[model samples]
Target chain A: MADLIALDDARDERLRDYTDLRDVQLRTTVEQERGIYIAEGEKVIHRAVAAGHTPKSLLLAPRWLDNLSDVLEATDAPAYVLTEKAIEQVTGFHVHRGALAAMQRPQEREPREVLAAARRVLVAEDLVDHTNIGAIMRNAAALGFDAVLLSPRCADPLYRRSIKVAMGAVFSLPWARLDDWYGAPALLRELGFTTYAMTLADDAVSLEDVEPAERAAVIVGSEGPGLTEHWQREADHRVIIPMAAGIDSLNVAASTAIACWHFSRR
Target chain B: MADLIALDDARDERLRDYTDLRDVQLRTTVEQERGIYIAEGEKVIHRAVAAGHTPKSLLLAPRWLDNLSDVLEATDAPAYVLTEKAIEQVTGFHVHRGALAAMQRPQEREPREVLAAARRVLVAEDLVDHTNIGAIMRNAAALGFDAVLLSPRCADPLYRRSIKVAMGAVFSLPWARLDDWYGAPALLRELGFTTYAMTLADDAVSLEDVEPAERAAVIVGSEGPGLTEHWQREADHRVIIPMAAGIDSLNVAASTAIACWHFSRR
Candidate 1:
């Protein structure tokens, strides 16, 4: 069982991880440096623990202690009990679910390990928005994509907002960032996966027209400019979701969902 | 051409329509009562004007004036020029695009008028999030669904955030809100549309298995509860996008995108 520590001050040094949760820029850097990721609410905390992540500490409202007792029992981490008002002051937002955990960040997995047994995969390139990363993770997992591979600059899937939006899919979906994004297409091909680059190029084949392969990797790009020319040229196939005339493209998350659905194995 | 009027005060009574934009509850009530909607940024403002929504007034920084001169030349509405800091004070947030317009809300169109020529349509039921509504509009428009029909309680697609997220697709897509929520399914059927309710029921047919109808209307529900039992039973078919086991469902916008793509006429 966890040690229950009652705290009255929001400025306590132990509550550092829970501070300024709304400041994405600052949280991203600080969390990374601290080697921790925040798991918000009961469900996400449970998922994180279930996924083999160790909790460094937990912050909970007095009312939520019993509700998350099972989770607390699973970890020896110190559980700080405080008023909901104090939580809001510390976190810069109301703790809607009244439970939070600062989990020890898991070691990064190699691409080879993540894709080794996967039959279908999603390769994300430079997706900057954490929400998009979370949504994409949910879409890919729900649609039966076995794993995900991210380009070097992709947003952290474990970001609190991403984890919340993904509803714990980020915990279950196996993903790894590529150290060398330029060679991703070739690497996937070497791993016996046929790669499909999603783009809006005029000559690209319609997504519906592409035949499903035994091992397939669908590459999606950043929100603004889309797939880099390097990935677009090197991927085995360039696919487009045929859109109505004059519409530029579907939102990245939306298009990823459609692509994942179109190539779903189930 | 619009008369360029300089304003130093954020609390000017003439800027009533542009106040408290970050406060959703207050803005929604106030804007609806005043029969006006805010179009944020350069692109959305232009789209609103092009969609025949008369601009009551425009708030812009001096830097944005030249960029929007063509639009100013097209309307007789007074343009209020102010510093970016003053705009922040008025709107309660930084106006990144440095331009905003208060456009007269177009009178609600009848369902029949919106669906008369649309072979494929989307029916949204109580989707409370403006961003989701906007995304759904962009998806439907991009995927070739010609019109949208909203439940009485659905969020306004012309809300500033929605318009920005949708990239002004709301201005191009024909949409109407149903007066009688209970009679919506029957009304669509009466208008020659075969309604398909998207649900996660065990007995629901897979979306891919359902053949496309000549006149199809896909109905999606609110974020949490999904399609109500009433709509699910009354619609011609209950269709589901088959998902991996243990996963609940995709984000509404993502699911809507997949559904729109599957049922696309083009």
Candidate 2:
């Protein structure tokens, strides 16, 4: 069982990891150096604990401690009971969720390893928005996508905002960074996967028309300039979600959900 | 042709609408009162123009004026061309998109009118988050949802951020508010529509099992507290997207997409 520590000072040294979060640069640097991120809200904290990402410490109001007794009992981390006002002061915002946990970043699997045994994988290329990345992971996890592979330009999935937005699915989903863009396609093909690059090109096959195979991968791109021409040309198939003619395209994350659902159904 | 006016002063009274945007309450008031919103970026501006939302005025760097010449030809709204520094000063931030348009909110149709002729519609109840609302609309539009109907508690579809996040689909798709929630489900049925409320109850039929009818309305709720019991009881069918065990539910917007796509296919 976790030790329950009472804290009244907002500036306690033990709470340094959760301080000054509104400063993006400082937060990013702290995340990079310490390799940890904060998960907000009781649901997300519970999810993180359930996924085996053991928290370093849990912070909550006295009222919440009883509610989270089960979660706290399952772990050896210290549960810091703080006044709601103190927590708000420390976190630099009103903590609406009543509970939060700071957890160390876990090591990510290699892209090849994440894809090796996968039947359906989502490959995100240059998806820079953290919220979109988080949303995609949540959708992928819910819809039964086996893994997510991120290109070099994609935002960090374990970022604080992404973690919050993903509802802690980022901790559970198998995600890997692929730096070698040129060789990644070959690796997927070697894994016996048919890579389906999502694009809006005229010649691409509609998502409804694409036949489902045993192992398939869906590649999504950044919001504005979608999948690169090289990727579209090199993939095993270019799949298009049939859309209204005048409409530009669905948002990247929404498109990812649609593609994942299609592939999962198949 | 639009008149090109040069403005070097940040304190100009004409630039009042573009100032202090980081203040949420002030901006919300502006959105509520004026029924007008700002569209950022050249692409979104172009989309607004394509959808027939006339630009009240265009604020851009002098260099972008030449690039926007063709788009400006159709509008008589004054185009304010300012230096990058002046534009930044006026908007209180660096306008990286190099252009912004003040668009008049188009008149909304009655919910009955939108539903009366539509084969498929999306109904949102108390979905307060603008981004989620926008994402839902974008998904609905992309996946063949003919119209969107919002209950009284739902977010404003015409809010500036919603319009931008939706990629301007709020202009393209038919949408309206239901001031009286008690009468909504009955009105929907009266319009020859079968209401399918999305829920996670064990007894609810899977979306796959709910055979699509001629006209169907897929109702979704906010993230935390789902659809009201009143609305749930009124639904002709309560359907759920079969999710993996341990996962509570997909995001409301994503679930709506999956449900919409299933119905669209039928």
Candidate 3:
């Protein structure tokens, strides 16, 4: 059984991971420095454990103890109980989700490990929004894409918000960041992926016209700026989802989902 | 040209239309009571005016005046100029998009009018999230769906956030709320629509199996709770997107987009 400890103060040293939860800048830095990410709510906590994430500890109100006893028992991590108010003070937000788990950040996988044996893959470039990244992961998993490859600047799939927004898809989909951002298309090409850049270039062919291949990489970019000029020019094919006139684009994540679905169907 | 009026006080009565912009509940009540809705930023404002909506007035920073001179010149409604800080104080937000507009809410169209000749239609039920509602509208417009029909409880498509998220697709897509929620299925049926309720019912057919009809209504529900049981049973057909095993569902808007894309193809 895991240790069940009582915590009284919000500033307790043992609860260092739970402080200032809403300060994005501070939380991002501290989470990185400590190599930890949080899983919010009961469902996400369940997903975290099921994904083989090692929970460093858990913080919840005493009332939630029985409901989550099994989660606590699955790991040797301690469960720290506090009054709801104290938990709120520590987190700087209401603990409406019942519980939170601080888990060890999984080591980054090599791009090859993620892409090996994949038939269809999503290549994301510098997607800055955590929600968009998470939604894209969920779409990738739902559509049965084999792998995900991210440019070095892409949002962290395991960021707390990303994981939550993805409904824990970050845990299920195999993803890795490219160490060589400049040579991503070349790397995918060498790995036998027919790289298709999703863009609005004038000469781009309709998404329906692109032939899905034995190994395919559907490359997408940030919402506003879109794929950098260098990457767009590097792709094997330029593809556009034929849209109704007068609209420039769909939300990045939505477009990615549609493209993935089309490629999977083909 | 719009009456060029400069206003310095955040508390001025003339700016009431733009006050407390971030308070959803208050804005919802006041907007409904006054028969008005706010359009945020230059693009949305332009779309609103272009949709034949009459502007009551506009609030913008002095710096944005020249950028929107043509838009202001197109309407006789007064334009109020305030310092960015004053605008922020009035709206409780930075007004970072350069302006906000108070426009007369277009009268709800008859469901028949929206469905008149639309071969593809989207029906939204109690979608409480404005962003989801807006995205659904964008998808409908982009996928070439003829119109949208909303449940009585749906978030307003013209809500500031919804307008912003839809990128003004709300103005282009004709939509109406069902006055008779309990009998909406019957109403659609009476109008010769082959109504398909998108649900997770165990016996539901795969979305691909449903035959696209000359007149179709693909109905979706709220983000979290989804369609009520009664409505689910009332539809002529129950359909589901074929998701990979172990996933619950996609975001409502994403699913709607895919479904629209499918129906349009057929």
Candidate 4:
């Protein structure tokens, strides 16, 4: 049961979690420091609740209250009701979906725990775009990758934009950040997974030519510079997706999708 | 040689092509009605020029002039020089790319002509998002697809955001809008292409199970609602990428990338 608080002012101090969301730098810092992330829209809010996340609070227009009544009933968090215009003023964007929840960010998971039961996993090294991270998470989950590991520099998968782009795939997919990025490849190898570093090096074998392994992990890199040389050198093997001449490469998300689909167990 | 004219005012009538670019409705209507499209940044501008698109005019900062000097020598279009702040004011958004060009939109190519020499092609139906269309173009080109065909309602491939996201792949890729979308599937078949309609229908066959053909075309629908019933019924085969249970589907761009990579001639 939630306490339905009607808010008339967008600048209310209690609404701090939902303010300045369009400022990525401010939100990233405030969110990490406070251990909270935002779930936008009805569907994503439902997913967050189903994933066992606790809600710190919710901000919603009157129209969304009924649709989210069950979610409110499941937690004791306060639900703030605001007019659509006031909600927009608070969030700094149109609340098109008409609902949002401030969820408690779960403590970071151990990389080994995420990979313990996994047979196929994805390792993202320094991917900095929230949309790209979200898209990759959706692809990995839909394509049947068991889990994911991210280098410390990777963008937050739980960012509002990332969650929206992923359509809540980030909630269901198990992922962990690697504190020691330099040793990530060796750790996966020791856990009985063969590692494939995706790259464009001339000597790299084509993704189509690589045989499926019983337990495999694919490592992808950042947008511009791609996989750092140290990470590429440390992986067990380098794999390249064969592309048409002259065109350099596919966008990171698209390329990762192809690799995930190919490596997924039939 | 381009005529470089210095301008201090953001309200110059000559800058109509570059005004309020952040307003999608206004720009779409204006650009199409005028038979022109914008090319942003130095790289995209260069690719647009290389693809034989004549620039009507260019809006640039002094810093970008030196880098674009060669392109200037190639075009007789007048170039308007402004400060970075003025460029931002005129465009209603920060011009981080520092250059913009209003280019003459190329005449639409006939589907038959674009597909005549093609063994592989991609057909996008009603994809209204510029980013998705751009990404799909990049994937299709990198995977060696011969050309692309768009439904009449599809977003313009030459839209600035699409061109930027595609990393100028749109300039190199041959694409055209179908004047008659209802007859599109049949047209592909008539041109001797085995059409594969991407869908989530239970009766659809796995993409991996399908054999490579002499000539193939993959049809992808819009972001939501997927393929129209008409297109699905008319396609030669309904194909689906095997996905994990409980997940609906991959992003249109990602699924299309996997399809293009799989159906590409090895």
State candidate 1's DockQ: 0.81
Per model, how much of the real contact set is kept? 0.91, 0.57, 0.51, 0.94
Residue-level lDDT tens digits of model 4 in B1-266:
99999999999999988999999989999999999999998988888888888999999999999999998998899999999999999999998889999999999898889999999899999999998999999999999999999998889888988988788888888888899999887788788999999998878999888886799989999867999999889998999898898887898999999999999844
- Candidate 4: residue A176 lDDT (0-100): 98
| lDDT for each residue of candidate 1 in B174-215, tens digit (9 for 90 to 100) | 999998999988888898889899998879999888887899
**Model 3, span B1-266: residue lDDT tens:** 99989999999999999999999999999998999999888878877888889899999999989878988888899999999999999999887886988999989899888888888889999898898999899888988888999988899888888988898999988888888889888888888999989987778998767788889999998767878998788988899877778876789878887888778777
lDDT of 2 by residue, A47-123 (tens): 77777787888889888887788888888988888999999899898888878888877776788778777899998
- Candidate 4 residues A215-240, lDDT tens each? 99999997679899997788888999
Chain B alone vs. reference chain B, TM-score for every model: 0.97, 0.94, 0.97, 0.98
Q: Which is the winner by lDDT between candidate 3 and candidate 4?
A: 4
List where candidate 3 sits over 4 angstroms from the true fold. none
All candidates' lDDT scores? 0.91, 0.84, 0.87, 0.91
Better of 1 and 4 by DockQ: 4
In model 4, state the lDDT of residue A33.
93
Q: Which parts of model 4 are misplaced by more than 4 Å?
A: none
lDDT, candidate 2, B1-266, per-residue tens: 99888888888888776777556668778866777788888888887888788788888887787778877898898888888888888877788888988877777778878886899999999999888889899889988889999988887776667877787888889999988888989999989999999988779998767788899999998878898999889999998777655555688878877887788877
